[model samples]
Target: MLFDGDNDQKNKFIDHSMWNRLINDAKTPLTKGVHQFQVDLEEFLNIEKPNSKRGDLKPINVIKKHVSGEIAMDKLEELKAIVHGITSV
Candidate 1:
């Protein structure tokens, strides 16, 4: 399983802060900005999936991995594009 330890290391990544704001911001309904949804999304990243590399498809983990330089440039670009699309809306 992909590991995100309990040290709050995500603070070291710029994208993590961006996502934290997006998820927690009172204006966005992306995940309703609610406590339960926040918890669920975090837990959801830990669930195993078939036919895919670990943490490859999870957006939450993607941000973490991308910011940590664990993922590819193309993947990062893809994520940026997606973010651009969302923020542009």
Candidate 2:
């Protein structure tokens, strides 16, 4: 027997696998904390969620209220460490 599939099938498979891996790996607090920080960063950048058209800048503006220069630098370092750890996996 022979089988055939389209690009969409392959893309979906890859996406599903990648998402599963990410979810499984996020069980650790270090990974979960970094992932949450990334989500917050996206919100602070006024990024619209998938399929959303509106961009709200209020969250971006509020960044300064919660983050200072020194704290920002420290967070940057933490982000880098998290990224490096993920990539090495």
Listed per model in order, the count of residue pairs whose N, CA or C atoms clash below 3 Å is 0, 0
**lDDT by residue (tens digit), candidate 1, 17-80:** 4554554454545532233123333343343333336545566664665467766666557545
Per-model CA lDDT versus the true structure: 0.44, 0.42
Clashing pairs in 1: none
**Which digits, one per residue and each the tens of the lDDT, describe model 2 over residues 9-72?**
2363265445544555656555423333323454433433432344365345445534644235
Worst 10 residues of 1 by lDDT: 31-40
User: How big is the positional error of residue 22 in model 1, measured in Å on the Cα after superposition?
Assistant: 19
Scored against the true structure, residue 16 in model 2 reaches a CA lDDT of 42
Best by the lDDT measure: 1
Clashes of 1: 0
* C-alpha root-mean-square deviation, candidate 1: 12.5
Q: TM-score per candidate, in order?
A: 0.29, 0.28
Residue 39 deviation, candidate 2, in Å? Answer: 5.7
